[model samples]
Target: MANPMKIRAAVKDGVTEVKVLMSHEMETGQRKDSSGNLVPAHFITELTVVWNGKTVLDAQFGPAVSKNPYLAFKFKGGAKGDKVVVTWKDNKGDSRTDEAAIA
Candidate 1:
């Protein structure tokens, strides 16, 4: 299993902002190892964020994204103490989900 994601969410002035940091190797398959062997592609393909049980953001990522990706976005209609969930799935069928309480 991968490491747990770091999530931060806060609501201010009726807007909720969320930030996430994911841990992954994100190999592009084109990179060569020290042994001169190509690395297999390993990257997140799908990501979803939900605020209080409602979908807020959905994204698709590719190998081009850097490792340990950081994502931040803002949405409307969230309050303090609301639940924010983030989930991501990689090309290798690996997935992770984390949640944060809006402050």
Candidate 2:
């Protein structure tokens, strides 16, 4: 299992901003190890963000993304007490979900 994600959310002027930090190796399958063996592809392929049970952001990523990726975005219609959830699934079938309340 991968490490838990770190999420932060805040609302201002009726808009909510979210930031996420995910921990993963994000191997591209093309890199060679010290033993001259190719590394298998391991990366987050799907990411979803939901605000108050409504999908706000959906994304698809590839192995090209850097390890321990950082994501940030903004959306409308959120309040200080609303819940914001972030979920991600990697190519290896590993998945994690984390939530935060708007500050």
Candidate 3:
């Protein structure tokens, strides 16, 4: 299992801002390892963010993304105490889901 994601959500002036820090190796197959062998590509392929059961952000990531990615986004119509959920699926079939309440 991977490390738990760090999520922070806050609402201000009817806009909710969410920040997330995802933990992943994000290895690209083109890279060479210590043994001079090509490393298998492993990176988050899809990501989604939902607030109050409504989709707020849906994105796709590729090998170009850096390891331990950090994302920040804003959406309208979220209130305090509402839930913000984030989910990501990697190319290797591994996935992670986490949530936070709006402050």
TM-score per prediction, in order, is: 0.97, 0.97, 0.97
Instruction: State model 3's lDDT.
Output: 0.94
| lDDT per model vs. reference | 0.93, 0.92, 0.94
Candidate 1 lDDT by residue in tens digits, 22-94: 9999999999999999989999999999987799999999999999999999999898888999999999999
* Residue range with the least summed lDDT across 10 consecutive positions in model 3: 73-82
Clashing pairs in 2: none
RMSD of each: 0.6, 0.7, 0.6
Off by over 4 Å in 1: none
Of models 2 and 3, which has the larger TM-score? 3
User: After superposing candidate 3, which stretches have Cα over 4 Å from the reference?
Assistant: none
**Model 2: per-residue Cα lDDT over 1-103, one tens digit each:** 8888889999889888999999989999999999999988899999999987799999999988999999999998899888899999998899999889899
lDDT of candidate 2 vs native?
A: 0.92
**Candidate order (lDDT):** 3, 1, 2
The TM-score, computed over Cα atoms with residue i paired to residue i, of candidate 3 is: 0.97
Please state the error at residue 4 of candidate 3 in Å: 0.8
* Residue lDDT tens for model 3, 10-83: 99999888999999999988999899999999999999999878999999999999999999988888888999
